[model samples]
Target: MAYFVTPEELVTSNGVDVRELGTGEQWYEAQPD
Candidate 1:
């Protein structure tokens, strides 16, 4: 599994702006079991 920090500004998978996260916040994608 891998994770990355979100940029200063980002767009969600659903194409929505997520400005709540702080810079360098860890972001992850959901994985199937």
Candidate 2:
């Protein structure tokens, strides 16, 4: 399965202004960005 979200939602939700996040075994953000 996969997860999806709109750019506006990402920015509004957590202030993430990125377009895409690619595949990876693990990902982490030490603190909110």
Best by lDDT: 1
Model 2 stretches with alpha carbons more than 4 Å out = 11-33
* Candidate 1 C-alpha error for residue 22, in Å: 9.2
Q: Which residue pairs in candidate 1 collide?
A: none
* TM-score list, all predictions: 0.31, 0.21
TM-score top scorer? 1
Model 1 / residue 16 / CA error / Å: 0.7
Candidate 2: worst 10 consecutive residues by lDDT?
23-32
User: Taking the tens digit of each residue's C-alpha lDDT, what string does model 1 give over 1-33?
Assistant: 333325654655555454555422333334232
